[model samples]
Target chain A: EAGVTQSPRYAVLQEGQAVSFWCDPISGHDTLYWYQQPRDQGPQLLVYFRDEAVIDNSQLPSDRFSAVRPKGTNSTLKIQSAKQGDTATYLCASSPGLGYSQNTLYFGAGTRLSVL
Target chain B: AQSVTQPDARVTVSEGASLQLRCKYSSSVTPYLFWYVQYPRQGLQLLLKYYSGDPVVQGVNGFEAEFSKSNSSFHLRKASVHWSDSAVYFCAVRNSGGSNAKLTFGKGTKLSVKS
Candidate 1:
């Protein structure tokens, strides 16, 4: 079975530059999530989707961060104006459903971003 | 709101020694719990999960966690350590009592094994 896939694995941007991270979730997965992990810290949820509709995006920075999963199979997270604080590993995970206890999130290698 | 706490930021032990990683949680009610491990330059992988019923759940790589409702804790334990087991371990909780809340993670504990 193929796992969740993300690209480009690494990205570097100067302040105010824009960047987009892409994710391809596992086949048949109904839930997709995006998280941000700072250095030596745990991942923080940025946004999530269930079959092309956003389930929650409360943590996403409205001013610069935007995510879309129009086809329900792939997703894209965009940062309009990158800042140093946005320099974190962008992680994408997928699960079968949102059944609370039954959901087991499978993650991708993540895109390590560095905003100068 | 649901939250997780990993009391130990780091732990060191010899290869043959036993290991235990502590986790505490706070929520309006007992939530679904989980443990995950992350290898160097890799993403998080599920170790185990607990919702209800038995207080103990077994996970991959000989890992197991015991949930204690009274203490509001779920601690990960291994019979003996291996060098390959050195990684960052994260404890998480979901608002599984009723809501569709997402999994919340702790700061994580970095385990180091000495051969």
Candidate 2:
């Protein structure tokens, strides 16, 4: 079975530029998540979707960041105006469901974004 | 809000030596805990998890973690270390009563093993 897949393994952009990261989750998984990992730090959850609906996006930076899992299968995270601090690896993960102790997130290799 | 703390930023050990990585969590109630390992240039992978029941839960690659409710700690352990075990390990937790899918992670502990 294929694991979570992300496109554009690497991206280099300048400040104020826009970029989008795509993720295709594992088949049969009901929950999908997006995380941002800055250098030397663990990945932090940005937003997540349970099926076609967003379950939590409280941590997302509203002004420039947006995410969509329209069909509940594939997801896209967009940054309207990138910043130097936005340079990080964007990761996507998936799990079977939200049931307690039933979910085990499977992650993708992640897209490394470098904003100048 | 729930949070996780990995006190050690890095740990170095020789092959065949025992290893222990500590993790602490703060939450209003008992939270579901997990340990994930990330290889170089790769994504994070689950090593072990703890919800309820036995404090010790075995995970992949002969790794195990003991959950101590008394101290609100979940520490990863291995009887013997291997050079292949070098990687960054993250400690995470999620509210059991709330959204079980959302996780809060620690800064991570990078383990280096010397042969």
lDDT of each: 0.92, 0.93
Off by over 4 Å in 2: A98-101
Model 1 chain A lDDT-worst window of ten: A96-105
What tens-digit string does per-residue lDDT give for candidate 1 at A52-99? 999899999999999999999999999998999998999999988646
Q: Find the 10 residues in a row with the least total lDDT in model 2 chain B.
A: B94-103
Residue B74, candidate 2: how far off, in angstroms? 0.2
Evaluated on CA atoms against the true complex, candidate 1 attains a DockQ of: 0.75
Q: Each candidate's DockQ score against the native complex?
A: 0.75, 0.82
Q: Give the TM-score of candidate 1.
A: 0.97
Question: Model 2: how large is the Cα RMSD against the reference?
Answer: 1.2
Give the clash total for candidate 1.
0
What's the lDDT of the predicted structure labeled candidate 2?
0.93
